[model samples]
Target: MSRPQQVLASYRSLLRATRIAFDGDHRVFMAARQQVRQGYETGRTELTSEPEHYDEIDKRLEHASGVALLLRSNIVQGQLMHRKANEEPLSTGDHGIASQSDESVYKLRIHKHTELGDNDAVKGGKTSLAGTAKKIKWSNIDE
Candidate 1:
């Protein structure tokens, strides 16, 4: 595809990814869309002014593609669920941080493209170099 076509495709992909990632959060969705628009506008001006720098344009395009992929696969939002009065509150951690059970329950907005895995990790839940996390018990959101 031509450079212009590639740029348009990248812009569309970024918008679509943001839409998927921030479905229920209007503020976040608008912010992400605005950022994407600004970035593309800046890139467009640069590319038009310096058509000789094909390498820079390609790098920017690659970065845009990566951002879209990250949005689709990694961005997950959560909605707070009402707390039940009957349930006992869990103990707070040493730093006074409330446990997940003690806090309001959250229903995660996990889309089909969101990454899924177990909670096992080498340290602090960081995934291994192989890029696979421990198995996590989660159900996907049906859109």
Candidate 2:
């Protein structure tokens, strides 16, 4: 391939990755907003003074907080990958799309888990933060 083609491919990959990252960020923002709304509605005294409602609101806030953190991390990682791909020279046959795919996968995984946690929160169930924290601590043990 020609130099122009390589540059164009890299640019295209970067644009695609940016789009996916933005979409993920938008979803996270929307989810957090929705959780806030739900929390406000459920926690209000106008609604019956049900303990379950308060618990649900708390869970929603917790789940939203977790998802927001994950999304922020994913966005930073995506930007780093994008910068690395753009600044570094690519060898022949090194399609820039691979980095985009990795970022997209990371975003998608976060989205999936966020949705799952949101659903569980709606049902007044616990989220995976406990497990996630354990994994994080375990991974950090050597550091």
Candidate 3:
């Protein structure tokens, strides 16, 4: 309809796209983690033992990591956009309320990204700890 309304709609669409991207990235990370665990358990010592498997898992993990970084950057940008939108008061029209809603959605998306980052960090930490424990056990056996 109006300029403000169009901006609001575009913001809404970007927010939705960001959310979907985040979800897909999260799934990719989970799958990669699972594959790593399976590989370790199945006694695949060499990275080239199953070249295709290793490559797929590596690519997925890399993509997930990149997406996570992108999401963090997007959160910052979204906050800036929300702040800009708030500073400029909307006129009384169809765009007015939509602009406000857009700000709210942006804030919500920022919160979601923060939460997702925390979750990913926790999962990665746990995986690291498990791997360290396994190494320690093997070292002890060798000694």
Candidate 4:
């Protein structure tokens, strides 16, 4: 594909990633969109002006693609919980929006893009700080 096409694809990927990452958070979504646009707009001239800068342009494109992947896979939105877990469960309104009477807990929005890893490392129970507690010095005041 041509360089221009590649650049456009990168821009679209970033926008879509941000949408997925910040679905309900309008402020953050707009901010991220602005940043992506600004980054591309600022670099457009320098990327096309010099032939030697093709390498730089390629690097930027790769970086943008990586950012999109990271956002899509690692980022997650959270739902606000108003009441305690022990309390009654929240009621979904007619519009399907949960009321935010309080700001205590957040329920993570896990989707297919969210990366899930095995618990092998956690189950291993290996510890480098095993003897850390024994290193503390205790002095008696009676002395």
- Candidate 2, after superposition: displacement of residue 140 in Å? 26
Candidate 1 TM-score to native: 0.74
For residue 23, model 2's alpha carbon misses the true position, in angstroms, by 8.1
Pairs of residues at least 3 apart in sequence or in different chains that clash in candidate 1:
117-136, 118-134, 118-135, 118-136
Clashing residue pairs found in predicted model 4 = none
**Lowest lDDT 10-residue stretch of candidate 1:** 90-99
The best candidate in terms of lDDT: 1
**Tens digit per residue, CA lDDT, model 2, 45-94:** 44443665555545544554554455433443232233243354422222
**Which stretches of model 4 miss by more than 4 angstroms?**
84-103, 121-143
TM-scores of all candidate predictions against the true structure: 0.74, 0.26, 0.23, 0.70
Per residue, candidate 4 scores C-alpha lDDT tens digits across 22-67 of: 8878999999999999999899855684678889989999999999
> Backbone collision count in every prediction?
4, 0, 0, 0
The reply for model 3, stretches above 4 Å from the true place, is 1-49, 76-143
lDDT against the true structure, per candidate, is: 0.74, 0.39, 0.39, 0.72
lDDT of 1 by residue, 1-143 (tens): 99879889999999999998998899999999999999988876767735687889899889999999999988878665566778776443221223254547556666567766555544555644246643533342343
Position 61, candidate 1: lDDT: 89
What is the alpha-carbon lDDT of model 1 when measured against the actual structure?
Answer: 0.74
lDDT of 3 by residue, 1-143 (tens): 64335434434444444554344346654664555355434433443435566565455445545554454434432222243553665433311112345554332222223322345545665643222311112221110
Model 2, residue 71: distance off in Å is 0.5
Each candidate's root-mean-square deviation in Å? 6.3, 18.8, 20.9, 15.1
